[model samples]
Target chain A: MKVQSVAVLWQIWSRKSFVTSSTLRAFSTSLINPSNSILMSPSLVSLDCPDTWTSGSVQSDRSSVQKYTSKHVAQILDGKVMAEEIRSGIALEVKRMKESIGQVPGLAVILVGQQRDSLTYVRNKKIGSEEVGIKFLMTMLPDNCTENEVCKALQSYSENPSVHGIILQLPLPRHLDEGKILGLLTLDKDVDGFHPVNIGNLAMLGREPLFIPCTPKGCIELLLRSGIDIKGKKAVVIGRSNIVGLPMSLLLQRHHATVTIIHAYTKNPDKVAHEADILITAAGVPNLVCRNWLKPGAIVVDVGTTPVEDPECEHGYRLIGDVCFEEASKVASAVTPVPGGVGPMTVAMLLHNTLESAKRAFKFS
Target chain B: MKVQSVAVLWQIWSRKSFVTSSTLRAFSTSLINPSNSILMSPSLVSLDCPDTWTSGSVQSDRSSVQKYTSKHVAQILDGKVMAEEIRSGIALEVKRMKESIGQVPGLAVILVGQQRDSLTYVRNKKIGSEEVGIKFLMTMLPDNCTENEVCKALQSYSENPSVHGIILQLPLPRHLDEGKILGLLTLDKDVDGFHPVNIGNLAMLGREPLFIPCTPKGCIELLLRSGIDIKGKKAVVIGRSNIVGLPMSLLLQRHHATVTIIHAYTKNPDKVAHEADILITAAGVPNLVCRNWLKPGAIVVDVGTTPVEDPECEHGYRLIGDVCFEEASKVASAVTPVPGGVGPMTVAMLLHNTLESAKRAFKFS
Candidate 1:
């Protein structure tokens, strides 16, 4: 994965640190434990993996785990590479479906306002969709559009036979009820999966989600690409936003990773940061993390992206992530830098989801 | 607050011998150690109350905890009465709103199929809603209704000015997609708060849930009613179902309790249970929990209700919860029973939500 992709995934997961750490921890420890009834050991969170040898058990590398070995560290979770892989996979499926079923996957982006960031995001998403071979369409509604007008327009698209997936850019106009406006998308066509039902299903373990949030999806892409063992590892997510943090934690916990979420309000946030095998920092604060807050050999994902003034930069500013990269690089076994980390991954996942929507719509998967 | 309630609460918290032994060991040895972040400083978990001094510390007597003199323990939480209190609170608001605003809270129940249990649950929920002074309406769709038809009906209720909350009763016919139906409900009218947006919001600690699921809501009721201080305590949620287990764990974690979710497919489920100050069992298994599964003074909320044949009972069947109530009671400081414990509280919370929906619709608040 590209370094940029990891940061985006990190930000998403960091948003869920407080709750994810402890829950994901239970998953890892419980995997090898056999003391409780199997009800808690349902097939999904089955801890049938290798028994965590006693704390004193010998390792392939007898050196302290603080030192890296093939066993301790695998390939970096490059979201960029993984995103390419997913897009390529989707493109192949799109090609196959076009030939075999005479249909293509379709994703419709709904932009309600003219925010520059939203515009950049949508443009990237559209391009990503095109790259992945999913059919893409978009609509721009005026900022002053009433909730009913927006609802009516969305209803038409939702009922349209050809539209398989729909996404309305975030930070919709102030007058519209964000929740109600998002509700207008069809569940099957809800490419963003911000729909409450998908979220509810995601929250419930053992159930599957129609669509997962983009950032968490990106993080999962990192984990799968890196071949890291999430089951039973202590994962901490920082931040608690609906878009990134909460759902990211749920996804990790579903994979049986014990997860903890740390938030701005947490009394001892720093103490919580040190407990992670996987540390995700999504709070937007620049240089919020120091070396002491990290455990030895931890894999860190930095999700923060703040503009800090730099005299050397031509733009008069440089993009910085939530983590203090200089300090973290030494303490963390490996870390994803801010600008090149999770950002790229989010775009890739969006394309991936759009492709998925297309495939499901076309009955290709 | 009351003798019976305190016993039930204690029985809910503490379960069995192995749990007690391991917990006792962990508690006694950890307070003085800096590495033990899992257990926080003594001052955080408990208030400056008498029972807290005893229960919050190690080696506190099970019998003594029964007294629950702590402000956060026996005196603070009582799920049964607390649920009732919440219901009455809602009822009072509902009555006031009806008198002042000429509008009653309206809840629409969509019951699909003829599963006996599902039907019973829907009916019970309807009764509970009416009892709280929320207007209840039912739409019983055929068991074999098409997913599209269900989606349309759910949408209608979501848009209908009369309906403030819409509930699609669970265990829909196997042919209909649950995700699609859940997705169609308007997020604002999603009183159950099963929608992804709401759930995604709930999973992040600081974000407030627009609607909290009935099961987890009920679990909170159990604790608040039983006087258990959730802050900075070790909580374990057994089962990771999005409905009861995962959300249950997250909500507890939000209260500042360190929560772990043990689920099926988890490597070692029982070992995780031993670490909990509070244990919530939501896996739908009968007698899944034995005395050995619980800590002596741990609180247990058994959310599962499974039916088993019992020739001794006149009905020829008996309902049991996830915990072995009788055996667990002796060992646990408090326990919620299979039939009467978390079950009623779910309905009560639903009613409260319905009333809330009405209040919001009428601007009563």
Candidate 2:
């Protein structure tokens, strides 16, 4: 149960006015040039050059400078639409399996504690699974439950023949050893892809992981579906969490992108970020990346989803991304929006992984 | 089974004259300044700035310019000396175990082919093990040996009470599935650390690998013993091989170094290499890196060892490194020599890993 810090909220609030103003400007620009609206932005004329861009800048040139002023408003990647399409395809596959073999994929989740965000995430997964015609199951435990209780729940899932994919929701209670719990899950049933062997396969050359952690897999899906080139591109991934950033970097490298990983201990992250032809930020720090941190026309994928309190919103809060959306949209060639971006795709990928696992189990594919 | 390319030999021969001239100059500088000889060199004054170093160079400054001309001759990171020290320490520990419990560690190696280089390497491991009071065993098979034979060999060592560490010599015959064969070795006895689970643990944070691959572990030891600071430093690794480059980058990241991996598809590798405070090259391309590829005062670890024909030498060939030794010596603060550098340290680390595995098995401290 990690809480958003006050400093992060303060930073998001401080930029709220700027976001509003820039959104209006972007909208006006789009209205003025409807046909090429996705690539045209008038507000980019005033964008500042990154601090690292100097006369002797290795990656900077007159052409890059000229291209910077001709700002390309980022086309929305629209992961929501992509995920919907994918889910529909998955639904059809499940239906086919049901009609042919009278069987459907089964996914089980073991969730401990009652963290609001985790609860919401689990609910979404359940809905997503059920919508795809897959059976969904969960085991919820109190926050103070013993390690043995959680292990028991995992053991049941592992032994169940119907359970094709099992996910142990992360950030387990403080007392339980997360690694030990994860190791106990049968490798073939580890749909979450947190097992060491799965990760090792992902990192190694000429080997494939049983499952790629959902978020990074989804991000790659969005990129591929958008027809963006990854081979030989310079990719920079911010944050090195095992789930997102680390695996994302490895996946990108597998796709032949020259990748650099920036973490908390990195010096001058902006300078490194600017070198990226494709930038993926999973720092979870809202507004951490600004316009100056980008290379103009670079593809930006924001995996950060921090919830900030907003009394005016329907849910009394809003999701913010690592990038300032308005600022990034003015410079990047394409960008994924917060709520409509990686989130939906992550859920979609989970369903896809489960279906694949079930298919393997049944030897149907 | 891997042979050096003719193009690589030609490149080495072309650079031979320059290496000779610079070595003499370096020798003269050392003679003049015997007290501070390790850091003083006269040849650095003529070194050229890296192509990426421009007026707006993010990492370049007046101090860097002055430092460039100061020409700090690289102090040798002597793996030979370090390996000797470490082996002596292992010998004492093995003696203590023998006296206290009447037990000693045993290492088993399975060599599927009689490749000259692989045979030499296996022989060295045997000598190193025996020197440290560990029992040494080898199972040699012809190049045409069947996959079943290799698997049977691995199974025997795996079940043997005396054998604590088992190494499957790499580059198996073309007919054999390398991964499938390596997988046959039991995890506890996987001293070479090629097991995917071991690599996954090394890559993931908050997890520990049972055994780290020998070469990368030895490179880190060299840097640590040389007093080179890794935390927060920009480290660049050239090549992405499973055994060296991939694990090296992950290990450096674990040490808090901001890591960037450069491979064949990487554009402008020298520009990225120049940004590193610690540069490790395992590209296997002889003299692939020059002075311009390094930052002044960078610590370089050369893992490349390509054999080039030399009738004058007793072995009829000499090993060449990826970095031009003379050029790197003039610019870098420290550099490891190809043959006596990572090679010996790798063997020492193998002995260390075997001892640790044996201790764990015997329940010895």
Highest TM-score among the candidates is held by which one? 2
Predictions' DockQ, in order:
0.14, 0.26
Question: All predictions: root-mean-square deviation over Cα?
Answer: 13.5, 11.5
Model 1: lDDT equals: 0.63
lDDT of 1 by residue, A1-365 (tens): 11222322223322232223433443444455554211111232232342222212212212344754444442244554444444445555566678887887777878897975567567666666666567778889898988887777788788876778888777788888887677667888887767766776676644567777767777766665565677667788876556676677777787767776765444345666786788887766667777777887888887666666778864454677777777777667777766656776677666666666666666665
Off by over 4 Å in 2: A1-66, B1-66
CAPRI-style quality class for the chain A–B interface of candidate 1: incorrect
lDDT, candidate 2, B253-299, per-residue tens? 88878899987767677888999989998887788889889988888
lDDT of 2 by residue, A173-270 (tens): 89999989899999998887879998898888877788888788888889988999886688999878788888999888887788999877676778
With candidate 1 superimposed using the best TM-score fit, by how many Å does residue A363's alpha carbon deviate from the native? 4.4
Error of 1 at A129 (Å): 4.3
- Clash count, candidate 1: 106
Binned by DockQ into CAPRI classes (incorrect, acceptable, medium, high), candidate 2 is: acceptable
List of chain B TM-scores, one per candidate: 0.77, 0.83
lDDT of each: 0.63, 0.76
